[model samples]
Target: MTIPEPGGPDALLWSEVPDPVPGPGEVVVDVRATAVNRADLLQRQGHYPPPPGAPAYPGLECSGMIGAIGPGVAGWEVGQEVCALLAGGGYAERVAVPAGQLLPVPAGVDLVDAAALPEVACTVWSNVVRLARLAEGETLLVHGGGSGIGTFAVQLGVALGATVVVTARAAKHERLRELGAAHTIDYREQDFLEEVRRVTDGRGADVVLDIMGASYLSRNVAALAADGRLVVIGMQGGRKGELDLGELLAKRGTLAATALRSRPTGQKAEIVRGVQEQVWPLVEAGRVRPVVDRRLPITEAAQAHRLVESSDHLGKVLLTLG
Candidate 1:
């Protein structure tokens, strides 16, 4: 898919584009599926652009078979089933991916559904586990529990032995609990900060994985347990919010915000390796699995975007190729 001009979902044009050649340390994938992400929506609206040297198209992850391999890339062969975390260019029939970013499809995950794993797995693993060091017996608060990232974080936190609490719509509460959320707060009807306090008996969350950004900044800090860590990964709720440093200091809380697409290739490769080593086994063992709301043909990319924008989907909405 090519975007001649950035606008709405309709801006995505499934027009012809030149085939991508595999560069050194890269492999070309015959893309079978790609998952829609909030980053794709932001790029579609012209608010976010791919990093330098990335494809102009908008997709962050894809699953496929290796079609070609570039020089200096080893241990991977053509025709191997694989999925990749992409900086861009996944919204097409084929994409060239750095070899280090490719992962074998888990023993039981469907090829198409595997597309949902790379991005969410890498993001949650890197932010929550690697950076924040969410330990066993801690309390994890995940905002936007119905989102791809949100759902994955909830499950991963549970798998790591943490008490998972999420803020989502009432409609998604039951499903989230089924996914291992210990408590679910209906953000529309309940104040998450208050709920977190009540659920933890006023101790608050030990680690908060937030997506709402600036809008939740103050409350997120206030909801932190002593020595808590807040990792902000998105800005859906405005980009600017005032923080009460005094409160944060009193709580001895730490705040960190991160983005995946803009990370250097080496850093991304490291994250990919971490996911493969630490997370892939959980997936293969069925402790964690991809949650997909629905799959649509690539031609219905616009519809998929609209579905995601509407926040009606429970998990990821995937776009598939023939």
Candidate 2:
């Protein structure tokens, strides 16, 4: 998928492109599947661009087999099954990726479904677990719990023994609860702050996994418990807002914002290795499952983008290659 020019979903064109060749310490993956993300949508709309030296396409992660390996690459060979966290270029039949960013598919995950794991797993684990330090017995509040990252966080938070609360549509509440959300707030019909307070008996969340950036800044602070951590990874709801420093200071709340892409290769590799060591086992044991909403052929990349923009799907939308 190539964007002729940044515009909308219609801007995506599925045309043949040059096959990627591996650079030193890199490998070429014969991409079997790639999943859609909000970053991809932003890139399609001209708001985001690939990092320096990364592919110019819009995808952020992919799963496939190693087709070729560059000199100095080790522990992986051609024909090995793997998925990778990419800065871009997953929207093609093949993509060149750093060797260290690659992860072997978990023991029980299907090849194509593995495409959904890399971005979300690394994202949630790095933010909620590493940054926020959400521990057992804490209460976590997740916004957009039906989203890809939200779904992953809800389950992982639960698996780690936290009482999870989520804000999503009423239709998605039952599924979110089944996935271990102790409380679900229908954002459309309820106030998330009130719901969080009610669920935790007047104590707010220990941590908040927030995607609506500036728009939710004030409320996120309001919903935090003392010493709470709020990690913002996306800005779907506009970019500027006023912060109540006094409020944040009173709560002793910590705020952080991060993006997986644009990080140095060494940082990405570290995150990948952590995911492999920590999250992969939970996946292999069937404690966490990939929540893919639907799959479309790569040629219909525009349709996939449209579906994601609609926000009607529960989990991930994937684009499959031949």
lDDT winner among the candidates? 1
lDDT of 1 by residue, 1-322 (tens): 8888989999999999999999999999999999999999999989999999999998999999999999999999999999999999999999999999999999999999999999999999999999999999999999999999999999999999999999999999999999999999999999999999999999999999999999999999999999999999999999999999999999989999999999999999999999999999999999999999999999999999999999989989999999
Clash pairs detected, candidate 1: none
**On a 0 to 100 scale, what is the lDDT of residue 75 in model 1?**
98
For residues 1-322, what per-residue lDDT tens digits would candidate 2 score against the true structure? 8998999899999888999999999999999999999999999999898889998898999999999999899999899999999999999999999998999999989999999999999999999988889999999999999999989999999989999999888999889999999999998989898888888888999999999999888999999999999999889887898899999999999999998999999999999999899899999998888899999999999899999998888889999998
Error of 1 at 205 (Å): 0.2
User: Global lDDT for candidate 2?
Assistant: 0.93
For residue 186, give model 2's deviation from the true position in Å: 0.8
Best by TM-score: 1
